[model samples]
Target: MKGWRAFLLRRLAGTAAVVLLLSIGVFGLLYLAPGSVQQTLLGIRPATAETIAAVQARYHLNDPVAVQYLRWLGGVLRGDLGTSIRTGVPVADMLGLRLPLTLALTGYGTLLAALAGVPLGVLGALRRGRAADRLVVTAGVVGLSAPPFAVGLLLLVVFALGLGWFPVYGAGEGLADQAWHLTLPAAALAVGAVGMLVRFSRAALVRELEQDYVVFARARGLAGPVVLGYALRNSLVPILTAAGLIVTGMLAGTVLVEVTFALPGLGSLLVESVTFKDVPVVQALALLLTLLIAAVNLLVDVGYSLVDPRVRLGGGPS
Candidate 1:
C-alpha cells in the first residue's frame, strides 16, 4: 500500500503534464479543421460578415489561437469546458449527464472481459494442448479477428433476435433495464478485450510457470495448485497492463457498440459533435478521452508497482 501510494504520487506530475500537452494538440487539431467554426455551426459555407463578426465577438474567434487555447484551457482548469457550438448548452453539463452512461457500458464490458477471459486463459495455459485448451484459444482468436460491429450484429441476431433475451436497441429505461439492454453491446465490446486478455494472460502464465521459482517450488514438494497460484500471482502485472489497454480502448468510446445499440455515450457524442461541427464539444470530449487514457495508463503503472517489488522499490518508469 505504501509503495502503491508513492508510485501514484510519482506519476501524478507526469500524468498532468501529458494531459496538458494532449489537450493542446486536440485543441489545435479542431482549430485547424476545414471551414470556420461559425460556418460549420451556422450550416453556411459562406457566412455573412455581420453574423461572423457576432460569433467572433461572442466566442472570441478573432482572438489569437494561443489566446483562444489558453482561454479554453483556463476554463477547463476552472471546472468549465465551454458551451457547445451547436446546442448552446455548456459542454461540461452535456458530458456530466452522458459520461456515467458511457462509464457504465465500459465497466460492464470490462467486467465481462475480466471474468471470462482471465479464467479461460489460465485454464488454456494449464491444459496446454488439450481439446478444451485448443477450443478456448481458437475462440479467443476468432473474437479478436472479428470487428466489433460484426460481432455485435451476430450477438444481436443470436441473443436479441433468436433467443430474445436482451434488448435489441437503446440502453433501455432504468438501471436494471439498462443492464439488460446493455448486455449485447457489452458482449461486443468484451470480445476483442477478452481475446487480448486471454492471449496475454496465457502467455504471461506460461512464461511464469517456466521460471526457476516454479521449478524450485515443485522441488520443495509444493502442491501443483500451490505452484500454479504462485505463478498466477507473479503473472498479474502483464495481465493488468493488457486490462488497462482494454479500458483505454473502452474509454475511447467503443464507437461501433454505442452506434449499433443506439446508446448515448461519449463515443456517439463525439461522432455527433463532429458531424454537426460542435467544436467545443469535440475539443472537450477529445481532451477528456486523452486524459482518461493517460489516467488508465497511470493506474496500470501503479498496478505494476503493487504486483512487483522491484517496480515499487527501485524501478522508475520502466
Candidate 2:
C-alpha cells in the first residue's frame, strides 16, 4: 500500500510538472506568433496610444508575459478558462458543448477497433501459415499504410456517391442521427487503430504462448481455446497500455475527421480558434487536452495493477 501510494504521488507530481511546462510553452508560442491580437481583431493598426492601451487592457495583454501566464494558470486552476476573443463566449461553455461529440466519436471508434482487431489478431496467430492469416496480414498492412483522410475520401466515394448508403457530410438530425452519420468517419479513424492493435496483440500473444507457464498449461490438458485465452489475458497489460496511448492519437485524429465531416466537435472548434487567433480559446483547449491525456494515462497505469496480480506484486515499471 505504501509503495503504491508513493508511486501514485510521484506520478501525480510528474503530471503536474508536465502540465505546467506545456502551458508555459503554449502560452509562449501564442505570445510569439506573428501579428498582434489587436491587429488581427481590428483589421487596422491602433495608431493612438490610448487605443493601444485600451486594447491591451481589454485583453489583459498589458501585463508582463510572466504575469499574464500566471493569471491564465491561476484561472485554469479555478476552472475559469476565460472568454473567446472571436465569439465573446466562455471557453468552458464552448468546450462543455463540443467535448461530448468528440468523446462519442472516439468511444465508438475505439469499440469498433477493438471488436475488429482482437478477433482478427487471435485468428491470424492461431492460423499462422494459412491463407486466412495472409489475408489478415495484408489487410493490416494496407490499413497501416493508408492515411486517414484518404480512407475517409474512399469511404465517402463508395458509401455516399457510389452506393448512397451513408451521408457525404454533416452530422444527422439528432444525436442518434449523428451516430448514423458517424459510421464511415469512425470506421475510417478505426482502420489504423485496428491494424496497430492487431499487430501488437498478435505479437504479444505469440510471445506469451511460448513462456513456460503456457507450456505447463498445455501439458495440463488445456484445450486450444483455453490456452489462447490464458495467453491473451496475460498479454492484455501491454494492449491496455497501447489503447491508452491511442486515445491521445484519436483526439488529434478527430481534427481531420471532424473537418472532413463537418462535425461540431472540439477539433473543429480548435481549428476555428487557430484561424481566428483566439488565444484564450486555444490555450484553454490545449490545457484541457493535456489534462485529459494525463488523467487517462494515470488511469491506465492504475488499471495495469488491477488487471495483473504480478504487476501489483512486482511493483516494477508500469
Candidate 3:
C-alpha cells in the first residue's frame, strides 16, 4: 500500500512537471510564431502606435516572455484560461462547451474500435493460418491504409448522402441525438484504430498462446475457452498499453476527423484558433491536451499493476 501510494504520488508529480514544461513550450512557440498577437487583435486597421500600445497594454503583450508565461500559469492555477481574442469569449467557457464533445468523440471511436477489433483479433489469433485469419488480416490492412479524413468522406457519401442514414453535419443536442449524429464521425475515427488494435491484440494473444503455461493448461484437459481466457488474461498488459496509446493518438487524430465531419469539437476550435492566432485559446488547449495525455499514461501505468501481479509499483517485479 505504501509503495503504491508513493508510486502514485511520483506519477502525479511527474505529470505536473510535464504539464509545466508543456505550458512553457506552448507559450514560447506562440510568442515566437510569425505575426504579433497585438496585430492580430488590431486586424486590418492601420497599425497606429496608439492602437498597438492599447492592444499590448490590454493583453499585457509588452511583458517579457517569462513574465507572460508566469501570468498565464497563475491564471491557470486559478481555473481561469483568459479570454479568446478571436471570439471575446472566456477560454474556459469555450472549452467547457467543446471539450466534452471532443472527449465524447474520442471515447466513442475508441469504444467502437475495441469492440470490433478485440473480438476479430482474438478470432484471427485462434484461427491462425486459416482462411478466416487471412481475411481478418486483409481487412485490417485495408483499414490501416485508409486515412481518417478519407474514411470520413466515404462514410459521409455512403451512409449520410446516399442512404441518408445519419446526419451530415453538426453535433446534435441531447444524449440520444448526439450519439446518432456522432456515429459516422466516430466510425471514421475508429477505422484505423481498429486496424492497429487488431494487429496488436492478435500478436499479443498469439505470443501468450505460445507460452509454456498455455500448453500446460491445454494438456491439463481444460476447455478451449478456459485456456483462451487464461491466455487473454496474461496478454492484457500489452493490450491495455496499446489501447492507452490509441486513446492519446485519437486526441490528435480528432483534428482531421472533426474537420471532415464538421463537428464543433476542440479539434475544430483549435483549427479556428490557430487560423486567427488566438494565443490564449491555443495555449490553453495545448496545455489541456498535454495534461490529458499524461493522465492517460498514468492510468495505463496503474492498470499494469491490476493486470499483472508481477508488475510492481516501485518498478520491480512483485
Candidate 4:
C-alpha cells in the first residue's frame, strides 16, 4: 500500500512539473514571435499608433506579458482554454471535438502495427536463417526507410485511385465512415511502427531463447511451443516499454499523416492554428499533447508491474 501511494505521489509530481514547463513554453512562444500581438491581430503592413492602441485595448494586449500569461494560465486551470483568434470559438471545444479523431487514428494504427509486427517477429526469430526471416527483415527495413506521407500517397493511389477500394481523402461522415477513410493513413503510420516492433521483438526473443532458463525449460520436457511461449512472454517487458514510447511518438507523427489524409483531427487543427497564429489554440494543443505523452509513460511504468511479478514484489522503483 505504501509503495503504491509513493508511486502515485511521484507520478503526480512529475505531471505537475510537466504542466508548469508546458505553460512556460507556451507563454514564451507567444511573446517571442516576430511581431507584437497588436501587429499580428491587425494583419496590416504598417501599424499606426492609434491602431496599435485600439488593438491592444481590444485584446488586453497592453498588459505585461507575465500578467497575460497568468490570466491565460488561470483560465486554463479553470477548464477554459480561451477563444481562438481565427474562428472566435472556444479552444477547449475545438479540441474536444478533434481530439477523438486523432485518438482513433492513433489507436487503430498502433493496434494494426502490434498485430502484424509481433507475429512476424516471433516467426522470424523461430525461423532464424529461413527465407521468411529474410523477407521480414527486408520488409522492416523498407518500412523504416519510407516516409509516412509518401507511403500514404502511394496507398491512396493504389487502393483509392487504381483499385477504387477506398476513398482518396477526407474522414467521411460518421465514426464508421471515418474509420474507412482512415485505413490508408493508419496503415501508412503503422508501417514504421511495425518495423521497429518487429526488429525489437525478434532480437529480444532471440536473446531470451538463448537464456539458461529457456534451455532448462526445454530440458524439462517442455515442447517447442511451450518453451517458446515461456521465453517470449518473459521477453515482452522491454517490447511493451518500446511500444509505449512509440505510441507517444505516433501522437506527434500523426500530424503529417492526418494532413495527408485530410482528416479533421487535432493534428489538422494544430497546423491551422499555427498558420493563423491562434495563440490560445496552439498553446492548448501543445499542453494537451505533452500531457498525453506523460500519461502514456506513466501507464507503461504501471504495466511493468503487471507484466512481471518481480516488479510488483517491490523489486525497485521504475
Candidate 5:
C-alpha cells in the first residue's frame, strides 16, 4: 500500500511539473505570434500612435512579457482565469459552457473508434494472410494517409450533401438531434483512430498468439476461442496505450472537425480566440486541453494495471 501510494504521488508530481512546462510554452508562443491583441482588434488598418498607446494601457499590453505571464499565472492559480477581451466574458465562464461540449464530441468519437477498431483488429489477426486481413490492413493504411479535415470534407459532401443522411453542421438543439448532427464529424475523427487501432491491435495479438504460452494452451486442448480470448487479454496493455494516444490526438485534431461541423466547442473557440488574439481565452484553453491529455495518460496507466495484474503503477515491474 505504501509503495503504491508513493508511486501515485510521484506520478502526480511528474504530471504537475509537465503541466507547468506546457502552460509556460503555450503562453510563450502566444506572445511570440505575430500581431498584438490591439492589432487584431483594430483590423487591417494601422492604428494611430495615441490609439495604440491607449490600447496597450487599457490591456497592460506594454508590460514585460514575463511580468504579464506571471500576472496571468497568478490569476490562474487563484481560480481567476481573467476575462475574454473579445467577448467581455470571464474566460472560465466561457470554458465552463464550452468544454463539456468539446469533451462530449471527442469522447463519443473515441468510443466509436474503439468499438470499430478493436473487433476488426481481432478478426484480422485471427484471419491473417486472408482477404479479411488484407482488407482491414488496406483500410487502416488509407485512414492513416488521409488528414481528418479532408475526411470531414469528403464525408460532408457524400453523407451530408450527397446521401442527405446526416446534417452538414451545427451542434443541434437537443440531445438526440445533437447526436444525429455529430455523426459525420464523429465518423471523421474516428476514421484515423480506428485505422490505427486496428493495425496496432492486430500486430499485438498476432505477436501474443505466437508466444510459447499460446502454443502450450493450444497443445493442452484449449478451445480456439478460449485461447484467442487469453491472447487478447495479454495484448490489451499496448492496445490501451494506442487508444489513449488516439484520444489525445483527437483533442488537438478537433479544431478542424469542430470548424467543419460548426460545433460550439472549445476547439472552435480556441481557433477564434487565436484569430482575434484573445490571450486569456487562448491561454486558458491550452492549459485545459493539456490537463485533459495528462489526465487521459494517467487513466491509461491505471488501465494498464487493471488489464494486467503483473503490471503495477507503483514503480513495480510489468
Candidate 6:
C-alpha cells in the first residue's frame, strides 16, 4: 500500500511537471507569433495606438510571458478559463457546453474498439494460419489504411445519404438520441484504433500462449477456456498500453472526424477558435487535452498493478 501510494504520488508529480513545460512551450509559441493579440482581436479595423493600448491593457498583452502564464494558470485553478475575445463568453462555459459531446464521442469510439478488437484479436490468435486469421489481418490492414475523415465521409454517404438510416447532421438531444447521432462519427474515429488493437492484442496473446507457463498449464490438463483465460490475463498489460495509445490518438483524430461529421464538439470548436485566433480558447483546450492524456497514462500505470499481481509499480513486489 505504501509503495503504491508513493508510486501514484510520483506519477502525479511527473504529470504536473510535464503539463507545466508543455504549457510554457505553447505559451512561448503564441508569444512569438507574427502580429500582436490586439491585431488579431481587432481584425479588419484600423489599429490606432489608443485602441491597441486598450486591447493590450485588457488582455495583459504587455506582460512578460511568465507573468501571463502564471495569471492564466491561476485563473484555471479557480475554474475560470478566461473570457473569449471573440464572443465575450467564458472559455470555461464554452468548454462546458462542448466537452460532454466530445467525451461521449471519445468514450463511444473507445468502447467500440475494445468490444470489436479484443474478440477479433483472440480469434485471430487462436486460429493462427487459418482463413479466419488471414481475413482478420486483411481487414485490419484496410481499416488502418483508411483515414478517419475518409471513413466518416464514406459512412455518411452510405448510411445517412444513400441508405437513409442515421441522421446526416447535428448532435441529437438526450442520451439515446445523442448516442444514435454519434454512432457513425464514433465508428470513424474507432476504426483505425480497432485495427491497431486487433493486431496488438493478437500478437500479445500469441506471445503469451507460447510462454513456458502456458505450456505447463496446458500439460496440467487445464480446460481450453481456463488455459485461454490465463493467457488472456497475462497479456492484459500490453493490451492496456495499446488502449491508452488508442485513446490519445482518438482525441487527436476527433478534429477531423468532427469536421467531417459537422458535430459541435471540442474538435470543431478548436478549429473555429484557431481560425478566429481565439487564444484563450485554444490555450485552455490544449492544456485540458494535455491533462487528459496525462490522466489516462496515470490510470494505465495503476491498472498495471491491479491487473497483474506479479507486477509492482515502484519496485519488486513487497
Displacement of residue 139 (Cα, Å) in model 1 is: 2.2
Q: Judge candidate 4 against the unseen true structure and give its global Cα lDDT, from 0 to 1.
A: 0.86
lDDT of 6 by residue, 151-215 (tens): 99999999999999999988999999999999999999889998998999999999999999999
Model 1 lDDT, full chain set:
0.85
Worst 10 residues of 5 by lDDT: 37-46
Q: Over the stretch 91-191, how does candidate 1's per-residue lDDT look in tens digits?
A: 98999888888889999999999999999999999988899889989988987887888889999899989999888888788989989988889889999
Task: State in Å the error of residue 132, model 5.
Answer: 1.7
All candidates: TM-score: 0.88, 0.91, 0.94, 0.92, 0.95, 0.92
lDDT ranking, best first: 3, 5, 6, 4, 1, 2
As a TM-score, model 3 comes out at: 0.94
Question: What local distance difference test score does each model get?
Answer: 0.85, 0.84, 0.90, 0.86, 0.90, 0.90
Query: Which residue ranges in model 1 land beyond 4 Å of their true spot?
Result: 1-10, 44-47, 219-221, 313-318
Span of 10 residues, lowest total lDDT, candidate 1: 309-318
Clash tally for model 4: 0
In model 4, the runs with Cα more than 4 Å from the true position are 35-40, 43-51, 313-318
**184-225: candidate 4 lDDT, tens digit per residue:** 989998999888888989989999999999989888888999
Where model 5 places Cα greater than 4 Å from the true spot, the runs are: 42-50
lDDT of 3 by residue, 1-318 (tens): 888789888888998888888778877777777887877787889999999999889888898989988888898899899999987999999999999999999999999999999899999999999999999999889988999899999999999999999999989999999999999999998999888888989999999999999899889999999999999999898889889988998899999889988899999999989877798899899988988898899889889989999999886887
lDDT of 3: 0.90
Which residue pairs overlap in candidate 6's backbone? none
